[model samples]
Target: MPQGPLFLARAVYRRRRLRDAARLLPVFGLLLLLLPAFGEQSGNLAHTAIYLFAVWALLILAACLLAPALSRSEAEGDPETDQGPQDMGDS
Candidate 1:
């Protein structure tokens, strides 16, 4: 493989991953935000169903947030990329 396109490709991959992690990190915290609410158990089937739905909804939302993050890692090669400080200046 030629060097030029590879470097550009890598830089693009890095930026995409940065963008993706930027997006997901908040919603990931939000799913954690729901954890306390998930534990208030009552024996009603309707309530159980609602809880189930809510948990799944959060799971889906978190997954939606994560989809890009995961894909970025996949494209960028190796999910072991550096998670450096959040660049507040760029935000």
Candidate 2:
């Protein structure tokens, strides 16, 4: 028996990881924002607010960055498949 390469194309692998990151970003942000609530200093509204805002900003930035990469990846993957609604030729 012979062994074969176990890795995907670099572009495909990166696209998949990026997509995973994009999907998990909200959950990550949620966990971070909730962390303050579980801490001993939960009464400090100012700190919590600042943490929430920072997380929000990071999430927004991540989304902005991922959007273009994802769109570009999809564009690179297949153009023919994404074109919507072929003609039925009823004419």
Candidate 3:
């Protein structure tokens, strides 16, 4: 049976490198939120907010589209390991 894209994404997020990359989403979001502060139009709070919001939304959309691909690349470069929780019952 063929696995769906969601299944592949779930598998990718299970990897350490991929998971680490995934954790950056919030950092990026915060940075994007602060972007208007660095702009020359800081005086125009409304325009700055709208511009920042649009850019941030686009960035988030791009990240969502790219995350799976990034994770897949990391998975390919690194060796696969057991992704499930450790079994403590043994030994």
Better of 1 and 2 by lDDT: 2
Better of 1 and 2 by TM-score: 2
What is the alpha-carbon lDDT for the whole of candidate 1? 0.64
Q: What does candidate 1 score on TM? A: 0.40
lDDT by candidate, in order shown: 0.64, 0.81, 0.67
Candidate 1 lDDT over residue span 58-89, tens digit each = 77786687777667666766432455555557
lDDT of 3: 0.67
Give the residue spans of candidate 3 off by over 4 A: 1-17, 37-42, 70-80, 83-91
Highest-lDDT candidate: 2
Clashing pairs in 2: none
Per-residue alpha-carbon lDDT of candidate 2 for residues 2-91, written as tens digits (9 for 90 to 100): 453587667767878888998999899889888887898637788778878998898899899999998998878733335688676753
What's the TM for model 3?
Answer: 0.44
Ranking by TM-score: 2, 3, 1
Model 2 shows how many backbone clashes? 0
Q: Arrange candidates by lDDT, highest first: which order? A: 2, 3, 1
Report residue 55 deviation for candidate 1 (angstroms).
0.8
Residue 56 CA error for candidate 3 (Å)? 2.5
| lDDT per residue as tens, model 3, 1-91 | 4343554454455565456656777787778788767767537778876878797888778688768877677657533343556566875
TM-score of each: 0.40, 0.73, 0.44
